[model samples]
Target: MQRDYFDRVHFWGRISSVTALAVMLGIPLSISLHFGIWPQAAGVLNGLLKIIPMFWSIAVIEVLTYAPLLGAGGTYLSFVTGNISNLKLPCAINAMQNAKVSPSSEEGEVISTIAVASSSITTTLIIAVGVLAFSPLLPVITAEDSAIAPAFKQVVPALFGALGAGYFSKHFKISLVPIAAGVLILLVFPALPVGTLIPVTVIISLLGAHLSYKHTQKKEKKRQNQA
Candidate 1:
């Protein structure tokens, strides 16, 4: 029954994902057709050359990092909707925690999907409302001296800081070495671009976590033998 459930979930995930891809691709094509305008081949190639290196690498890394946390269903929805780490991940973690489920389990998958989907819905509604009121809100938010401008700039960091602190507090062993590595790298190589920094941090963090886990297991086993 569990296997069948996952099979169905994966099957539908593929279908919906493919459909979403088609729609996204179709939008650009439809706009080009309607406007009877096409970008110059050289310009298009130049643009891709500028963006593809960074964006593609980050895309691959994001998939690797997020797929496990999100599971099949939530992964599909999060990829389509975007904003995984900042929004979906924290929300899903909180949901799974509340439900007392490990993220590696089926119950975790279901609850994470529920959390991510609910977040997606709420985000969509908020965006729609924002759009409706954007004309009035825009000037106030964009003004150079706007009181709320700093809040907007700080949202992502605030969200990440809160979530990261909570998780790192719980699993400091896995996170400590990587975080230290991050600080050292930033200090030593302060000029690393945003694109390079992200994937580099992820790679370093995973390696550190893996080594830490092994050391922890060894210490625990040694303690058990001594006892």
Candidate 2:
């Protein structure tokens, strides 16, 4: 039964990912056809040359970093729907924590997928409603001097800070390396993109965790010997 479930998940995940890619590509193609104005080969190549390097690297990094925590189904949904970092990941982590399931377990896969799916649906509905009903408030909301501008600016930071605090408290030693490295890197190269920093910190954090675990094991072995 477990094998059958994973088989079906893989089948549908691949299908949906491909379909999403096609729909995304089809949009610009359709627009160009309707206008009878296709971009020149040189122009397209130039644009891709500028974009592909950064985006391609980040795509690979995000997949490697997020896949384990998200599980197969959740990873597929998060990638397809976008906003993995700020929304889907947080939702999935919170759900798994609540359900008391490890990410590698079958229960975690189900919970993570459900969390991501629900977030995607809720996001879509919110966007639709905002577009239809809040169009008039866009100017107010976006104005630099608006009353709520300060609060809006802090939303992403506040969300991440809250999540970071929880995780850091749980894994203080392992978290220190990445936190310090990230701060130092940003201070040294302020222009560096956040996407580029993600994988660097992830690598550093993994190394830190490995070393911490090994040290703990060594101490345990020494204590056993003394006893």
Candidate 3:
């Protein structure tokens, strides 16, 4: 009998997922609080943030664990067989296998994917709700609006900028292609609905990845020929 993949994530993976979720949420929250906007909604925001660890525990245990292990077999087959179409088969098989005992098997792996996606969405919604719910209470907690509210709103971009800076610092010139592509997208984005930005950004990023991967392969071949 096959053991359920959801039950099989190593202890370390749970720890990693917990750490990732904390790091993801904590940085933005910390930045917002430091800017003083948090005090206004401190009670609600703190309560919501505190609950995330528990939520993450459930998501990691019930959802994301299978995608890596069972999906790996499919990925390997796709690579060796040169048939990328078969990639989903393994993921589907794993999902079905796991679903047999899952409480909501009717929802299946799509539900798991949505659960993982919802984690990010839920975090954003929690912050938005906290701000909206506590806006009236701000006067009681603070002297005035000042720059704190704007700074709090800036947390998402600031967090992303810090991440991008870190990546660029490590990768250097390799990051330039994506940076250029992003600039191009931004330039054209004003003419298009905001929804188009995401797909364009994704395509540009993938193109950058492909170029970088090809460059690395070529460099490796050159080094091998020199030796």
Per-prediction TM-score to the true structure, in the order listed: 0.86, 0.92, 0.40
The residue ranges of model 3 lying beyond 4 angstroms of the native Cα positions read 1-3, 6-135, 138-147, 191-195
Give the C-alpha miss distance for residue 118 in model 2, angstroms: 1.1
Q: Which candidate gets the maximum TM-score versus the true structure?
A: 2
lDDT of candidate model 2 versus the reference: 0.92
Model 3, range 79-119, lDDT digits (tens) per residue?
22221222232334434444543323434534334333344
What are the RMSD figures for all models against the true structure? 2.4, 1.8, 17.8
Candidate lDDT scores, in order, read: 0.85, 0.92, 0.52
Cα displacement (angstroms), candidate 1, residue 34, comes to 2.3
Tens-place lDDT per residue, model 2, 80-197, is 8899888899999988988989899999999999999999999999989999999999888879999888998897889889878878888887998898999999999999987788
The deviation in Å at residue 208 for candidate 1 is: 3.9
- Model 2 lDDT at residue 171: 84
Compose the digit string of candidate 1's lDDT tens values, residues 146-185.
9888888889888778878877888877787667777788
lDDT ranking of the models: 2, 1, 3
